[model samples]
Target: MAAAPPPPSCCLVALPPHAKDGLVVFGKNSARPRDEVQEVVYFPAADHEPESKVECTYISVDQVPKTHAIVISRPAWLWGAEMGANDQG
Candidate 1:
């Protein structure tokens, strides 16, 4: 039988406002199948599809900048993103 995937791990650190050209770095390792790994982009948008606005279902339109950009690491078998970072950071 195949082995189970490893649990997730994450870390976040805040940078000083004066910091320039700073690098936001983190390491992630997953034992999931290679075919399931995928890179995805999450552009902030409104959640108008649902009849009733679900609480915390998505990022609010106002919270996102006009040029906001987000890059995410996702697993194809999962319904949501595993981790991501935004340009503003």
Candidate 2:
């Protein structure tokens, strides 16, 4: 079988520290249509189930000041996330 194609290319920017009005903002643009992009929240945690084989590469609960809410942009057709920010910031 042929391999699945990669998702659309995207550009992301985290606003500078000196952003106007002192607001911290993140922006992203992707070649995918707006209809296929979505906003979601993930409560990240380790998969401790013995039978499960998935591993999380991002933050683990024990490795931070504390875990916080994760707000993210997700692609409708893929399990991978596009971009996100935590409540910590």
Q: Largest TM-score belongs to which candidate?
A: 2
Tens-place lDDT digits, model 1, residues 1-89: 99988466545454554345675445566555767757675766343443343233344233322334667777765544677777676
Angstrom error of the Cα, residue 64, model 1: value is 13
Give candidate 2's whole-model lDDT: 0.60
Q: List, residue by residue over 1-89, the lDDT tens digit for candidate 2.
A: 99989657756555656577767665666676757757576766433443434334543333443345676777665555777777676
Q: How far is candidate 2 from the true structure (C-alpha RMSD, Å)?
A: 9.5
Clashes (backbone N, CA, C under 3 Å), per candidate, total: 0, 0
Q: How well does candidate 2 score on lDDT at residue 13?
A: 51
Q: How close is candidate 1 to the true structure, as a TM-score?
A: 0.42
Q: Model 1 clash pairs?
A: none
How well does candidate 1 score on lDDT at residue 60? 29
Candidate 1 worst ten-residue window by lDDT: 57-66
